[model samples]
Target: MNYVILAGGSGTRLWPISRNSKPKQLSQLVGDLSMIEETYHRLGKNQSVFISTNSQFAPLIKKLLPDIPAENYIIEPDKRDTGPAMAFVAAWMSLKHPNNPMILLPSDHHIRDKRTFMEVIEAAENLINSRQVLINIGIQPTFPNTSLGYLEVGEEISKEAGVHVYEFKRQKEKPDYKTAKKFLDQGNFFWNVGSFAWTPNKFIEAYKKFAPVIGDHLNELIHDLESGGDGSEAFSRMEKVSIDYAVIEKIDPRQVLTIRGDFGWADLGSWDQLFDQLADKADAEGNLVKANWHGVDTRNTLIYGPADKIITTLGVSDLVIVDSDDALLVTPMSRAKDVKKIVELLSYKKLQQHL
Candidate 1:
């Protein structure tokens, strides 16, 4: 199957490390290689792969993803969410390979169990060949996660896919803690991983049905690009929305199917999530350090600084200290998820360079 990566998040929660100029996908937040590189390698083999990102990221991605042809990069001129972003991708792919099944992935997710992940992806890809359903790869929820979206499943489709295929009942994005507990109790909800598989034509049809305005806008821009005109202005005019809101949620329930993702997955959206993902790599005091550091009486704290700079903490507990060249962050681990607000405050203060 062909692949298209939605590489357009600003990654505000990551703050100084992930900024508007360089998103999280382009940063080496987890391992030696950047997140995007890891995602490319993890795909194993595919006919072709494309990355759709904002214009600021185009040149960087070009230099970074050398194996992918420069033409494969789709640059959104303005910041629109996944609704227009993905519609644009589907439109472009339909022009090139209408019948080919395509898999869409978010570039910034962390997957520890790639074996099970690929198995689920293969099953979803296979389902699209025989069925024209809009596929959503839903991870079985490990906990009551309030920050992420949830998917409710209905009837089973088949057990042959190495997973139980299910009818997608509905989608609920970012439910409250109480509702999340109820979902877990019902035992039918899954975390919406934002990965999907569908033939290009089927996706186009769904866009036409549920999100026609976005489809038209992207089609116009694609036509402009084909005729040697830059679609910068056209793209800037497209509506800013997400696929979940515009298309996925509105689709006929009977036409949607979900494959169970039993693999280890985390968006790593917040510092706490990152901490959990790297727990095994932490020190005895439950501190994860990615810098030159000397500490005393520090417990359950994280310290990240420039590789060459020594960051020392004394008598601090449950605090996160991240030292960049221009900015230093100190916050309680309990509020790690609120780092995105710091980015917003920076913008409000006209701290453009830091953002």
Candidate 2:
């Protein structure tokens, strides 16, 4: 199976540290390795791999993955969401590795237990017989998180899917707090981790059958590429939507399957999530610190800054303080979701430099 990673994200929730120039996936926030590098290394060195990113961070991707051939860099001219991007992958792969099953991974996610992660993907690969099915790698939820959507799982069909591969019941899209808690209590929900595996021809066929708008755009792109016409420009005008919203949720229930990923997975989209996932990075007082900080009676807080700057906290608890070279973000731990709003406010104020 060939692996492709989606590396486009408008860094918003994790601002200050993540900007338009560099999103969290490209940042070395968790370890010595940047998130993308970590993701590549987690997959074995023997597999064929590709990265799908927009024009902005293509240089950094090139610099990081020098061994990857120039042709493998699937750089789109502009940012369209995952729907168009996945369609692009299928269209490109049909021209290149036509028969290969493609495993799509999110460019930025903290996945502990790489062996278990691969075990899940490999299991998904084994079961992928046609385009009628795309196996979603679902992480068993550890908490009632309202920020993420849930996958309701049904019947298991294979030995590999002891409980891993199951009929996908329905999507519980970012449910209310009460509903989230109810899902957690129900014990059948898995967090939609955005990792999927399926063959290109089949996936593209499924797209044409389900999402005609995206399918038409994919057809146009393929036609343009073959004719040596302006394919990228045509792709740029395609509707912006996510693969999940456009196709996955809309597909016949039999078209989607779920495989259990045993790894500890978390999409570090918000400060609080970042703090929670890297629990080892925190002190006993529940404070996760990266920057120069002198704390006085601080507990359950995260303080981080760029280089050579000291951020001091006084008698504060449950807060996130980050100092980027151009911006400073300070918010309560509970309001981690509001960071995206702050990014919006910056855009509204025409503070382009800060973003």
Candidate 3:
């Protein structure tokens, strides 16, 4: 099986520190290593790993993950959404390594349990090897998160290596607060972690059947690949839609299967989520500090800055303070998810340096 890490996100939610030149995946947000580095090392050194990113980030990702060979870097010519991006990957893999099952993984997630993660991947691989079906790894939801998608699962179909495999009933993409709470209350719903596994040919056939426009463009991509072309023109012609809307939601529920993954999983997409991931390391006052910080009455806040700068906060609570070289962000914890609005404002003001 081929493990392809998707690393093409701009990461606007984590602004100032996460810039256009260097996104969150390249930043060392968790520990000493970058997020992409942590993700790569989590898979261990034995598996066949590949990177799926755009040309702009390809050089930086290559620098970060030097262990992966040049041929393993699948560079997308355009900045299309996941629908076209994934279909292009399927086309490339089918042309190069046909019949091999591939797993699409996020490059910037934090997984606390590596052993259990590998076990879940092994179970998914086993199921994919036995059947020609798309497999999605579902993480047990810990909270009523309206930002993430939810997967409604049915009866358990089978068990692979102690992992319970369920029938994927349907996917609800970013529901309202009430619906999210209802999903949390129900025991059958799981958070869609976006980790999927299937053979390249199977996914290509899915595209051909459901999203025929993308499937038509995929044929041009395959032909371009065979004829030593980059397929940029063919890629840009496809619509910019997510994989869920294009193929996954349109496919029959019986055609898709999901496995329950109990391993510690968290998508560090925003500052609030990152604070939650590192909450265990907080100080007595519930402050997660990464820089030289001195607080008098700061509680339940996240302080991140450069090593040279000293961040001091007094009489502040439930806040996110991030100090970069050029920009400083101070927002209440409740509004940390709206940092992307600042990025949008910067883009509108033509302030590319701050992005």
Candidate 4:
């Protein structure tokens, strides 16, 4: 099997820390290593891996993974979203290895249970080989998250595949509290983790069925890819769309299957999400600190950074105070979602340096 790492997100939602040039995947958000590096390590042995990213990230990735082949990096011409980028990847792979199966993964997600994650991938690979169906790895939702998209299983493909994935229902965009509870009660919904697996030929066929323009461009795009063109033509010619809208969501019910992901996963999209994952539960004062720190009246707050900087808090509750040498962020937990608004406001005021 081959691996395609989709690494072209701007990570606008995680601004200040994640900038346009340095997205969250490149940032050291969760652990000591960058998310991309961790993603590379998590994959099983003996798999050809391809990284799809923009030009800005190319050199950085090369520096990080010097052992990886230079040709494995698939640089997009522009931000055309996942569908087109994935089409290009599939088409390219088809030209070289049409029979080889490919696993598509986002570069920025945090996967905690790697062994279980690999098991899910193995299961998907087996299903693809035996049943010739495209697989969508869907994570079991741990909370009522409004930020993520959900997948509804249509029917069971196999009773003993350990998981039964049916047809993918239309996406529910950030459901209200009542609707979210209803989904949970239904017990058939799974969080769309965006991980996918298919043979190169299967991928191209799916694209041709759902997105003919991208499928038609395969030959010419592959030529440009081989010749190492500037990527101007391909980017301009391809339509900007997501995989869900262009293919999976649009495909006939019989062509798809959903595989439940038991691997602990998080998109790492927001600080609040990170808080939920990393906050020390043992802190009695509700003051979560990564390094050495002293606190006063700082309840239900998170502080992350160096031990030298004494992030002293007074009369602050339900807040997130992060102190980096280049930037300092102080916001109530409820208002953390508005950080993008802060980014926009900062941009409007011509505070480009801070951005």
Per-model TM values vs. the true structure: 0.95, 0.93, 0.97, 0.91
TM-score of predicted structure 3 = 0.97
Count clashing residue pairs per candidate.
0, 1, 0, 2
Mark the regions of model 1 whose C-alpha exceeds 4 Å error after superposition.
45-47, 233-237
Off by over 4 Å in 4: 44-47, 159-177, 280-282, 306-308
lDDT of all predictions: 0.82, 0.81, 0.90, 0.76
Top candidate on lDDT is 3
Model 4 / residue 84 / CA error / Å: 1.4
Candidate 1 lDDT at 339 equals 95
lDDT of 1 at 196: 84
lDDT of 4 at 261: 79
lDDT of 1 by residue, 1-355 (tens): 8888878777788767788888889988887878888888888744388888877787887787788887787776667788877777776777788888889999898888888878777787788887877789888777789988999999776974576789899999889999998888889999998898898788878877888667667667778867766677666776788889988889898888988877878887877788878888999998998888999989888777789888888999888788888888888999999998999898999999998
Better of 1 and 2 by lDDT: 1
Stretches of model 2 off by over 4 angstroms after superposition: 129-132, 161-163, 227-230
Q: Tens-digit lDDT track for model 4 on 239-289?
A: 888887778877775666788877778777877777777655438876667
Candidate 4 Cα RMSD after full superposition onto the native fold (Å): 2.3
| Model 3 lDDT tens row, 173-289 | 998989989999988999998888999999999999999868888889999988989889889888988899899899998888999988899888899999989999999999998
Q: Least lDDT summed over 10 consecutive residues: which range in candidate 3?
A: 45-54
Model 1 / residue 147 / CA error / Å: 1.5
